[model samples]
Target: MSPEISVSTNEHKVLGACPHDCPDTCSMVITVRDGIAVKVQGNAEHPATAGALCTKVSRYTERSYHPERMLHPLRRTGPKGSGQFEQVTWDEALSDIAARLQAIAARDPQAIQPYSYAGTMGRVQGEGMAARFFNQLGAARLDRTICASAGAEALTQTLGHKVGMRVEFFAESQLILIWGSNAIASSVHFWRHVQTAKRNGAKVICIDPRRSETAEKCHQHIALLPGTDAALALGLMHELIVNDWLDHDYIARHTLGWDALRTRALEWTPERTAEVCGITVEEVQGLARDYGQSARAGQATAIRMNYGLQRVRGGGNAVRAIACLPALVGAWRQRAGGVLLSSSGYVPVQAAALERPELLAGRTPRTINMSTIGDDLLRPASPEFGPAIEALIVYNSNPVAVAPESAKVVQGFARDDLFTVVLEHFQTDTADYADYVLPATTQLEHWDVHSSYGHTDILLNRPSIAPLGQARSNAQIFRDLAHHMGYTDPVFAESDESLCRTAFGDQVDFDLLLTRGHAPLPVPEAPFADGGFPTPSGKCEFFSARLAARGDDGLPNHVPNFEPAGADPRYPLAMISPPARNFLNSTFVNVQSLRSIEGEPLVEMHASDAAARQIADGDVVRVFNGRGTHECVARVCERARPGVVNGLGIWWRKLGRDGTNVNELTSQRLTDMGRAPTFYDCAVEVVRV
Candidate 1:
């Protein structure tokens, strides 16, 4: 349903969607006055958004109109990483960039790489035109595994896709497990549903390494060690089996390889799980009891898993184990049951049509994992590494700040030989090292389309104002670059509005989106209720034969963190770098209001650890490991557990106290299954500076 738009001679409302990397994908109404966007608010009519917006998104107007917003193309005048640039005309910038890219393509198109991820989750602006450009150029394929790849791959292995129960159904759930998610900070709208479920006498449990705000409000919190989620899941399964909580009929009819999974789960006793997860045996037993009783009583029990848990060594296995729980007691039988890591798989996005990969003309270039860009960038061309990276086109992401092992990333970006171009609204840490910085428009000045991962809604964004100054949308920037490069592909001529329509084509009701601003997909209330799981067997597979064929374990099992707590003599603590509540990664770190709210970068340590290190609250401290040292204020509080420190992060490297953020201590090591970054599985120690 669409909210009513009020219009006058001088003012009117335009419908759009929040384009940030968020699950809500909130439907927004832009109040425009005389061709200028005056205000932005959530559409009350959108069920998932529920007329509410997070602090960062609510202040989007400030971001769009910030004083430092890049309004013109800039050419770097000083050395790389010097943050020196001179304004240039769009023609000069595009022509120079195109010429450089063409020169690199002439040698080897694989030398040119396009780096981007979720700066705008909009289909049209994100990869619609940009992908076409890269494919046509036969540039190196980027394996975008920075964030959700591990969990997404796990979901695909276990659930056949990243599908899940409808998020709105959580309100009717009798029990909710907010696993590895700080719902209050990252998923505000989903927290609303949990609050509603709480009001209705439902029990809530939070499973996370950190004692997040959501954990504080939950009925129970299991502060387990990071990367131990699979063990905990197995412990719960053991309890379900030993206590006779199984749904025998569901298991027999709708599951595959249950016997093997049962055997593996049975081996994990409560004591063993407690030791591995670094929690009390009582905590494990109590949580298992709660979950089993809820399922046995035929009440709805839901799990809201987020990407945070999957940013570890064994993240994929953890997701696989947790995904098997709903089927253990037939939780999918109820609309309010089952688990939701992502609802994205339910939406049938026409990715091939949108990206036009056929433009590659049968060329298969080398793939580069974004997580290991630090190492990849420094690697010379070889038999396996292929061509050395010569040109980098960055949009939507700031790798120098967000990528792990920032020291290496910085070293690679500082190479005078590397030609780099950035499209941004501000001079980010990465942009500071750019050969050219092209101005990119904000969501308020773009035509785009979005599909939500929190809800099954396809939302459309209509530009409310013209691009400010000389800024342009990401799609427009790519289209112009394609033209300058002498590309004759007709697809490059498509307008932003036409790209938005092409995003879904006939698969979705484009007419409905045009009228209502949002349209829900025809997904069922209980999609897997009758055991149609979209898997090869048409049922939940406890053991994936496909994985077995690939020589990996078919059944999910606990894989310990590469940097386990107390394993290193010098770095006895495990560090997890979660995003600051006021910022989404590094997006709003430059916003004065949001940055003021976040204060300075912080590393939260338990009182015991603080005392041992002679560090006091608010004391300047150095958090160090083998990789690098990060300087930040130490926050000694109950929010942190013993042996674990929380380094709230994604602060720009330039904004940090010592010109280094949390990523300075993070490694470039990848996860077990998806080859994604192991951001959380880090070992570190804190001491007074």
Candidate 2:
């Protein structure tokens, strides 16, 4: 391993963006010396990142030039899951992949599935080129709904658009409600505004099942049972309506179906909701009173909602119900009063053009939701479901560690008939099972365009340094594969620079983006200030006819989740898996520095639960459900609620006790809407190992 050091006068800086799965797509400047990246720091000019980088990204140089990073293509020399491979030239690898893909296409092109997610936020390397290649081959469409899809769709239906309140408006808020999000860990840039809002006399409140780091720092933390967010939100609505605290004028002017929503809210009384949510009736009333009175007093309130509340059975409905709060209080009229669901809608990138979905060759391929990758991998082909997947090309994701039903996913990966290919920078747990592990370039060596979902900044990632070895960006890899497979579509030959230019519409100047590092979209400073929603009725849909047509609840309503009922003796505790502070998914967990900082993968249990199981704080415990089991060190404390436990996200099987990943105990059941994975709606039992 080489240490990153400044070369005095020879060191130069290049502007880019952090290409992680985070909402805060931070603008960055990489320090390069002698064609090697020496350091990574946030671009001071970018408002979202300010000038400081997060703990994980600050060590970008180490990750780029890590000794264990795969630098060349390799073919399997041992059995699957053995992590043994022999170096192969790019020519040999591409030829073999092309031949196999040709064979697969002859029988059924839909048998080829491309697995990916937000591994890199780059416009070209992340999604564009590969999507074009897959579309041309008429491959099965990967439904890419593993995260944010449910919330995005639900909010889109209610608010008519997914764009939330402006990030800059948080400082002007008088009340900040951080719901189901750990801003400190996931969205650090946004957390700065929260801190400033708190300093400016705004009351900060956090609502989460676990007392997370962000929760501990907030002025108030309301710990509720997991999957009960909808119930609590409805209870707040009930209090607001029963007490006549709603903004009837705003509702009449800027919304539709208010009567239906009001009727639904009245069904969940404070006492009933409190009992269901495991909170006191007084607490419920107090929350409604504070939010309602604060709004009526001309004090603006902001709700920062994230994906944590939407990984359950009623995930989409929960988001829709919570998103209606701002409208109920007439929050949209104020700069900082509306709900912030996501900033994704701010950038109008021509994704369909970049992906060239017209290349599907008139074959309406089967769509497979990514959340059910475990089931998809194991299930045999049937007449109803088309052909079984024969070849899986994985890039920008580690499904084995991050996907639900880890045991089943691993079992499917071990199938002898499956031909698996992985493109990665490191030998992740998923890579360990790949038949071909192709080396991939780090962000420093790639060209990409990034648009943040947390902020309205569009940034460019330039090649600060040359490719380290034979490594290639995902875009280049797909281009090479397409050429060898006899596809001469002009779209495959499109340059990364061209893709970046096409990411935004005419509002952006591509030349200026390269020079300035980042540029803000020409959107209104206060979007939705006048209540011109983009819905069918040009108003917020308090009752959505689209949902009703789909046989879903027309009004914002609470639907019960899959938490175990009647205090089942087999699985008594609910488990919530959240992102670790130091790692993004499973990306940085292998870095020695980050691994040391994160210490070990442990199960955090409440003191009472630990005591009942006769397990001490440091005791090794087994967490199991009917799905599967996992073992880890126990951290018994009050951080987690008595009936609930917490397991940090995406630890490799080898790193955990008894070689078990937390996802092993999680089910792959799809949510009622959005076909999202119900990761947080699981029941497990903890016992001494």
Highest lDDT against the true fold, candidate: 1
- For model 1, how does the per-residue alpha-carbon lDDT over 7-106 read when each residue is reduced to its tens digit? 8888888889999898989999889898888888888878888788899988999999999999999999999999999999999999999999989999
Q: Give the distance in Å from residue 421's predicted Cα in candidate 1 to where it truly belongs.
A: 0.6
Tens-digit lDDT string for candidate 2 (35-73): 778789988878888898999999999999999999999
- TM-score (C-alpha) between model 1 and the true structure: 0.99
Q: For each of the candidates, give the backbone clash count.
A: 0, 0
lDDT values of the candidates? 0.93, 0.87
What global local distance difference test value does model 1 have?
Answer: 0.93
Lowest-sum lDDT 10-residue window in model 2: 1-10
Instruction: Pull out the clashing pairs in model 2.
Output: none
Q: Estimate each model's TM-score.
A: 0.99, 0.98
Off by over 4 Å in 2: 1-9, 565-567
Q: How high is the lDDT of residue 208 in model 1?
A: 96
